[model samples]
Target: MSSSPAKPTSQHTSDHFRFHRPLAHLSGPFGNDSFALRAEAFARFFGTPLFLGAQTLIVVLWVGCNMAGLVHFDLYPFILLNLAFSLQSAYAAPLILLAQTRQAARDKAHADADAQHREALAVANETRLAAAALNSQQMLTLLQQNTELTEMTRQLTERIERLTVEMHERFVIHGSAP
Candidate 1:
């Protein structure tokens, strides 16, 4: 443990320590141990081109030295070299597996997030469609109400015109020049 506190990463969640996904160690439920992180980093480094090239160079030099009688170590059979390969494999396999497991977990998390996003988008679209339907209904009702109001206004105007004519007739009957 260092004097400083661990910083949280975006991918970290409340349950991050339960699973090792992307950035869980960077910022998660549990603070990462520096030594463990360093060891994992070192284990991952074995897969690089630099490591492969260096290993090849060492093997070639070892074989050449043994073949030329300059070095008698593991002569002809190269049992020591074979043992080194076996040892490397034993350690490398587990480290590689650890990295793979971590990567798989990270991929699963991304997939889950994508699924959640898609679901949320679908829900939003559904909500928008529902709102549109309600708006359409409201618009239809308003239009019907407007049509009814217009018809009532026309009927009222006709009735007023009939009344005025009746009043004019009554005034004529009384010999008024209206």
Candidate 2:
């Protein structure tokens, strides 16, 4: 089998990230916050399979140990487990909301940047179209002028031919009479 060489790309194709340059200052949400960043990460971890599986395994072990009489830390009611879940929920709810709010802000910035880029492209397209239209109009006017000059040259050539023929006839007739 024969292999084909790679096709060359234009400069426009290489500028895919040009639209994102303006959003550089708005990186990682509206502003930088070490605590908020950590909390966001923690909140994100709460929804992952790894955290869920680990939590489930721990709860199972706790119940198994208590039921088997291996430990007397909590009775069958499992009030301690309930309190732990409540505490986790108390922290998780606010952190998740914080993460969501930051994400929404970042999304808005990106959308605005995209809108600006699109507007710039539209303006450029209009400029190019206007220039093309003007060039076309100028070319048509030049063509008209060239056609008029050609017609004038043809008329002058015909006049010169007629004058030459009349002069030749006069010279032949007058010379013969003499």
lDDT of 2 by residue, 1-178 (tens): 9799867778536877878888776665424589756766788799999999999999999999999999999869999989999999999998778777878877898998888888999999999999999999999999999999999999999999999888778788566442
The residue-level lDDT of candidate 1 at 90 comes to: 93
Cα-based RMSD of the predictions, in order? 10.7, 4.9
Q: Which ten residues in a row have the lowest lDDT in candidate 1?
A: 22-31
lDDT of 2 at 6: 65
Tens digit per residue, CA lDDT, model 1, 123-165: 9999999999999999999999999999999999999999999
| TM-score of every candidate | 0.71, 0.79
Q: Rate the local accuracy (lDDT) of all candidates.
A: 0.79, 0.85
The parts of candidate 2 lying over 4 Å away from their true place are 1-13, 30-36, 171-178
